[model samples]
Target chain A: MAQQPSSDGTAGLRELGEFGLIDRITASVARTENGTVALGPGDDSAVVLAPDGRVVISTDVYVEGRHFRRDWSSAEDIGHRVAAAALADVSAMGAKPTALVVGLACPADTELSWLDGLTKGLADEAITAEAQIAGGDVSRADVVFISVTALGDLAGLPAVTRSGAAPGGVVAIAGTVGNAAAGLAILSRGFRSGKAYIDAHRRPQPPYAEGPRAAEAGALAMCDVSDGLLQDLGHIAAASGVLIDIDGSAFEIEPRMAEIASALGQDPRAWVYGGGDDHALVAAYPDRSHVPEGWRVIGSVWPVPDGGEPAVTIDGEHPEISGGWGHFAG
Target chain B: MAQQPSSDGTAGLRELGEFGLIDRITASVARTENGTVALGPGDDSAVVLAPDGRVVISTDVYVEGRHFRRDWSSAEDIGHRVAAAALADVSAMGAKPTALVVGLACPADTELSWLDGLTKGLADEAITAEAQIAGGDVSRADVVFISVTALGDLAGLPAVTRSGAAPGGVVAIAGTVGNAAAGLAILSRGFRSGKAYIDAHRRPQPPYAEGPRAAEAGALAMCDVSDGLLQDLGHIAAASGVLIDIDGSAFEIEPRMAEIASALGQDPRAWVYGGGDDHALVAAYPDRSHVPEGWRVIGSVWPVPDGGEPAVTIDGEHPEISGGWGHFAG
Candidate 1:
């Protein structure tokens, strides 16, 4: 299985004891410096500030051999990307992340360094979003997995839900879409030259601030593109009772992605439309004029015909089904 | 592997699909009646009310075998017990749980009924605590595990932490202790006659309300008895800079547990002092007058002399080291 939690793998979790492991995981957190933390780890529960009177919460689970492979990804990368995945859900709701409570289930033989790297990754991502690691839990298990619960504050703004889009709305993207998928494809083929794409997959740098920015700009609907562009937009269409028509010609694959796609005998556009996990923020706006600066217009919304099911199409027709979800390769 | 997802040994999670599984899990929740849900499942994240301007949050992870054995514990019991474990953490901070976001990682072949039973257990426990299931995430793994994140409202009260105990403080407990450990012991011996003990182990009914009541009563410090009376109290002593002395004569072994221990040639007192997981609320109060009606006094707090270590003792003497931690048997 090539499972090496630590070199020599002698010092495992049981040797460290429960409290000892917990202390190491959260010891460096400066709880007092975190503005939202009224109470932090080592207590029964952490008390976090919810100044907006509401908190947006979401959970994401990452399991070894499913979401990641230790042979391909480092512990830090797994932690960072998993946090980004859950935090992006909060962003899709147009909330600013406040705190995260993480839970790790692993074999007692897990390496302390591997756990440390995971903690560092989670903390790094949370700090990037200006959130704090408030608390966490650990347990012994055969497989290694992490579960993160991300909490965010709305700051008194109305959430931009999936049902808010209208017939005349414009759809836009706020971060790199499909890059992570492209990266996963590269890795699966046993090549590692595509550093940019691979890094994107390893640690998603989601445009977190753009969520609150979109809400402020009167965006109609929003969601993070984690299930590929077409599938995710289809959800927006169904929820908003509208039809979405993406302009196929709008996307121009960058040199880095295109070069790799060419060598691999793949169409980059399919990756753009069907690949997921880049954690890009996709939203519907009134028009191009109202779209924020960081976002690029990609599609348009249309009314669903009477008794017609909501759908997402490329240039007025359904795109070909690729039937490829890269994360499932394991 | 004894993997039976359905009676026909088919219809695993991969067959039902992710959305279908999630829909069945959350379909029956009355989100509207919850009173604190600004938004519920079906969205990227759920928004819960935090009118108190603060939220108490905690996480706990439970793994198969380490936490529960399918042959020993029903899916519902596993879910219920896991939820109780996390919720007790919130109550230990003197807060009322508002919502929970759960994460499940299991084999693709997991039984739909098993998953359903687990969902029911979690929802039932959350409902009993006046909390709602806000959201959840699922992933495929070789082993089944669950992680829960509980959020609670402090209701404008200062959080009660472990560092608040003082000398001469009265140590008291609300709800039963040691029963769960006794149940585990009985089960390990292949005896199922102790229904009450077994049920206590399966579904710990922590006095959740008493936490806030204790806070209102001006209790000094508190924690759920998770690692036995002596060990958990040792934490209070270490954190509060005080030493604790249990009144050995103060505890009474209930007939249900005593009878089982007697049959097994085990001292129930060992289970009482060295067992864990009853989730009873243990607290330190200034005096008898300040102790809440539901709580019963069991020990006293004393000052730790300068440069002396904090410790927990029984009647000014170190209790016998039984070296028994029932949970570790798995």
Candidate 2:
């Protein structure tokens, strides 16, 4: 997405070449005290500790136009966003991230400082998640694309799967949904004054530590809100063979989002229900008491009758919104 | 690369959408008897067994125009080649590949059948290496790019790194070099008559099992011939602080390549020495007696003199190769 003219006085990636960029990148990042990554980049492959006997892995791809625009977001923001998208998957599995590897394809003419900024941003998030940026690969392409794979350890606990939700379970969510979508809405209308919303869209701060806390609190099923709350909860319902009902009244739209929605002639509640990339953690617990702090109970689960399909509903009826469910096209 | 008209009656990726493409791709692959992947796609993340307490991981990105061409190579061949590139890195670590994850970014208009072919090809190599295609992600992009991350288990063995080469060590290779480069050469000239070379260009058959064998046989240092033998051996020399000498007379070029080269007015031996993508295993052993079966001794190692830099030589002298050493650019 960095189709902009270079403002960097120094040489860009084309001048540095792949090896030079890799060397500069590796030299910049500091190794953590944590020994998760036994061997980082520069070798044929990275060696990561998987002391819990298993590794939780997930991959996500981000493209130029489909994921982000260089004009709207900085290279660092794009990096953090892409890394969050992948790392959140690991966190949602009730695991502690150990390492993440990146695969980047961009035009050879890309700015060296911009690529460095992206790498630094990725490292920032990895450090926050207590994970190491273990390794990466780079290739030349006409358009930019980044693919990140995160590996996590369960810390000797079984993974919390989506199929474990049961009837009578309380559904809860930690962190905000619709903030990113609302932010995207703000950015789409050619407005930049909404700093909070725009920043939320730039780099979503997923409650990474909350996932394992929810698992330890005896949550049955869990997932991250990448595709909005209702759409993602639908996954749990289908897998757990249970009917999930969300209280539409549970959503409390922020004052700023509401004010902006009114000005934009959009519904703020729809953003709460259908916006994606908030990276919020959602789980179904045995009861309200099992839900951890920072996670609020928003719904309940019920059994599916024979020949009945598992589904999600808002207040005993299907919910409708004026706009479609996804706002992640930013 | 798949910008061509779709001949398949089935709906393409654009019509199917990302989720649908994922479902179809996952459904087509079979699980092996091995219990490497504790959980496959469908949940938030995949669970892969890393019983050895550590995992060796590597990633590689293959773009359509830079790494492959639709008219030159089939989707299946591209898949196999990309898989081999990453898996070989794991093997070079003397680890057994357990699982691999894929990150694909291509135009939504890409054909589903073609993608299936790529998936099948990836599965083919995974199955061969006794590994699984545990998970993958899909995204919309202007061009096609495949990023594969391979995870491997060392089975409690120490990794055989490039820094282990020592003076008096014997250099050996388990597979051919230059065949892939020669194949690409033939294909680039619009000649498909060189079936062996053309097939090598399409799919590289790396000796995956030999990696662990070399480790078990006490290989002092090891790596896969990715950037060609001379260039890759240069890595060992640099890392180990040793001088490597390849016996030019040891290389035996195949008659078929020589015949094609004569017809094409090219040097087949140059391909044998400098061509890449053969995915051959190169190692330095204590002596010729320590070399494993199917691996031939090709050279020797020596110490770098004080104030002298580590280097590679041919027949006790520096050798010049006509053209470049990259056969992997195809």
Candidate 3:
């Protein structure tokens, strides 16, 4: 039998049960501003006043083994990754993140401290993203799983779409591009979680403000780089019905990123081209207008050649590296 | 060797990778509401406009072994459960569900048909709830897990809280209870999934409109019965700091529920008293004036005597049965 619970253990999650867990979690949580939250947690459904009558939302999931192994990453890391990914969806639309809801499932033997760590991680990221954890569900399972949903405030701004980039717009990036990939590689090769790369993998700090800033700067199209730079850019190119060309030499290199490449005995180029999860801001800017801080011109949008395939090309060629992670391909 | 890809067997999830699977899923999916979707899939995040500057959100998780089983439930059933539970959170808050975000993590070997079934089930519930699937993330894992987050609009109704009920308020319910417990018993007893009890287990069609309607009808306190009736009601009692007495005589017994209880050779009273997952509406209203249709009065709220325990009592007695489900009981 597993270890027994003592007075220290008190009433663990199993003691609370699913409904009881929800009751305790929702007990102290409440809405601050956001008039839309007419009804908060602890009901059949929460009610929010959607004044403009329209809402924007996005969701993401993080699995214990696939996304981050418990041995290599702390529970706090898992929490940050979950929250960041979900909030990035809100940022991708040139909107400000407003709230987040989380669903967590773990083995009954899981420590309550782990749950607290995860919640603390989520709360930290919410503060970073200017969002709040509104409500969520918790349950027992064989493995740990986290699901996050993020909502946003458009603030009456017109959404910049991937399909809206024109032929003449300049493609620019506004955040670190290859750090997460390097971090993943570092973690994969049995290295200890380095403070630098581990943070990249655990908490991908996306350029939240850049999304709305780019929108205000007349960005024709925009996206966040969860998939590798080339692959994600290809999506924009295909959707906009155009060609995107990246100048390999124009890429901005992070000095510390090279450390991961050296450790993995792999070229930094692979991480730059095929790595993802950096959550960088990529936008198509018209007339190469004044680039925002932390942004650099990396490529250009081109008209599709007559009857030609819409594709992303780098330095006049398609690089032969893997184009990033997929969920169902194994 | 067991079933290689060359032998007409599909590649596993790890083989296809995360990005490949995401590309495939997003490739053919259609965006129904382009205006509401500020950003579509394939980015770090997708953004949408939330004009009202307010948001309502909730989340829930459905696990394979704990929440459902492949042997007992189709992917569709699992999906329906996830949608219902998440949407019910919105309903409980007296809000209209507007959108949903799903997180799916499953084994690589899972069949495509199963995923399709789950998606169809989710869509079916969304249609019933008048909500749309906005976006989701897909990833690989050892076991199938589903996490859903739902958003809603409150239309400016004051939230009905659990602590709002006062002494002398009438206690009411909008749907049946104990059916899911009966269903779980049948499943655990090795009986195959049945059309009746299985339906109760697979899809808990809570009276979604009752929450908002109760709010409109001036419900002082409200909650969904995800725990046993007495236990869940006890939550309101404790939150409102009042004693609740259930008049067991007023329970509107259902014939089907009785049949299932008889088949299992168990007390239906236990299901009603301590079983959970019904997702029914239970509320306390002042004076019982103009109670909505389909709601049956079952009890009354009373002032706690000085130095007396504030608890739920049935017919003026504490039933021998334990209150309800707990998660971490050793």
Candidate 4:
């Protein structure tokens, strides 16, 4: 296998060639979507089926310096991160991912092999989600931009929305929360270099199938931990006319999470409450037992008594982890 | 309705906010599809149907200062242009557009109102195609980047491929060609000053419905004139193992084309033969009468003699225009 070249190389995009790079990237991917994909990649457009009569879609873009820094992450890792972000949206909708289309933009200085590695990472994640890499576009730009659109099938379940949670429902999480946040802090603190923190930033292993499972299990409301657990849950609280209470004691920091907390000399609570990009699924189920994936029960939903603003309280107190991931705030 | 403010406005993307901008942009856009859209925008993902049990998709990206200049094109125009480019790919495959997902990256200095206007343009184009603007992602970057993916339904037609044309087939076109090229020249040479040239640069109106018409009319090979007539037709010829011959008399250039040529003292053939972004449908049909609405006969497809290279020729000779647009040539 030809290894991806480093960006430090002076060869521009034209030197690498467009069609040649595309062929290299697409060579590793395989099409397997139960005949719903009439046409896969390499055509003007690809065709897939809405076999269940409905299709679900979401799109996301990741820029080179803003979303991912080449100094901090590998091309493969960036591809995985981008794919995870888009797929997490699909999962949050209580849908099954079926396909993904990606658009790539890079400076002329980009190498063909780097793109090939990115494609591999993207395809691997798609396969893990039981989806196919349907199609994509490529062009030249000053920096790299990765745009992904993930399509999904609802499978006959009424989408469990952020606005659907009723008072008295149980608040739970189906995957790691704050892992990516902790990872971010670890990277920023320059404390330690470990594969765990690297993977958290590079490729978040979101519980892909848990979304449909949660919907089937009667999740009243749900969202992924893209914007921190409490911040995201607050969106549900506002939408569903309820208050979500987080049991602070219920939080159990995983080894990686604990490691980051110790190194940074910070409480894991901050990361747990305010960290983003873990892509963990947070949902409210009518009955705690109905929560699939053995998700830990964290708290319960409460009605905002007599017209008060919706909020999220951690053990009767508001935990502080300021605004989550402001785009332009210095 | 408030008019979109320029990027220098007080309420910018980083100020008026992410969710707030999204709400403004998504307002008033139609979400209904052919009952094939399972889930519409506003969630993690939207779902649609690919009735032929397959899905066709394509993506393209445009960046500020590369594909378009912010000083020249309005945000709304940029949105429209992006959609047109992607939609042309679906039309090239003889498919009906179903949905569009856009990814936008803008600087913090970008006005929130401008983003809204850009969304309006995208939604308007989506409505024009009777497709839904499903979902998208926004990120903060130094330069504005727009990525679009167009999903289409093939409806059981064996994709009329560029490689499928046969010898002795009539070549025809549906919709205007060379106008966009002429407009480009006018803009480049500082010829035309107002709406006509600007409109050509901002929004391209391809014969959207004629794609399926050509497919139904038994077009053996087809593609949209995105990369100029002869160059695009050259793709068909090279793919189909046939020689494509064009007659100059068959072409009907707009009056502005000659004006543009005269101003630059360059042949109008450059615009007709090498120009792109026209989005006109070009196809080879066995019978001329099978040509669909707005289409005119222009050339014929002939078998390559004794295994010579499948090529494009004009009036029994190979004529040259400025080479087609190359992404990284600059």
Total backbone collisions, model 1: 1
Error of 2 at B167 (Å): 0.4
lDDT of 4 by residue, B1-330 (tens): 123333544476655456655555566355424454655656666666666655667888888887887766687887788888898788778888888877788897787667766877887787777777766777788899998888777788878778788887889988777667767766676665535644676688877788888888899988888767877888889878899999888875667667657867877778778777778888999877777767889898888889488889988788757437666656
TM-score of every candidate relative to the true structure: 0.94, 0.95, 0.89, 0.92
Instruction: Give the alpha carbon lDDT tens digit for every residue of A183-251 in model 4.
Output: 777777765665576567678899888888888888988888887888888888888889899898788
Candidates' C-alpha lDDT: 0.83, 0.84, 0.73, 0.76
CAPRI quality band, candidate 2: medium
Cα lDDT tens digits, model 1, A1-330, are 112233443467765666667777776455314687778788889988999999999898888878888889998898889889988999999999888888887877777778877888888888888888888887777778788899899999998889899998899999987788889889999997999899988888999999999999889999998878887898799899999998877778888888999999988887888777888999999988989989989999999989888999888998886423432123
Task: Name model 4 segments beyond 4 Å from true.
Answer: A1-11, A30-36, A254-259, B1-10, B28-38, B49-53, B193-198, B252-255
Runs of candidate 3 with Cα error greater than 4 angstroms are A1-53, A192-195, A252-260, B1-53, B192-195, B252-260
lDDT of 4 at A158: 77
Q: Cα lDDT for residue A15, model 4?
A: 54
Better of 1 and 3 by DockQ: 1
Please report the interface RMSD of model 3 to 1 decimal. Answer: 4.5
lDDT of 2 by residue, A15-82 (tens): 56566666776765655326898888888899999999899999988888878898888988998898
User: Where does the lowest 10-residue lDDT sum fall in candidate 3 chain A?
Assistant: A1-10
Report the Cα interface RMSD of each model, rounded to 1 decimal: 4.8, 4.9, 4.5, 3.5
Would you list the clashing residue pairs of candidate 1?
A: B5-B111
Q: Write candidate 1's Cα lDDT for B1-330 as tens digits.
A: 112223452467765667666666777455313787778887889999999999999998888878888888899998889888888989988898888888888877788778877888888888888888888877677778789898888887788888888998899999887888888888888897988888888888988898888889998899888778787788788899898988988887888677788899999988888777788989999988999899999999999878888988899887885423422123
- Model 2 lDDT tens row, B1-330: 112323462556655655666677787665443678988988899999999999999999888988899889999999999999999999998998999999888776677777888888999988888889888887777789899999999888899899999999999999888889889989989987878778887899989899889888999889998877877888899999999999988886777878889988988877877777888999999999999898999999999979988988888887676333221122
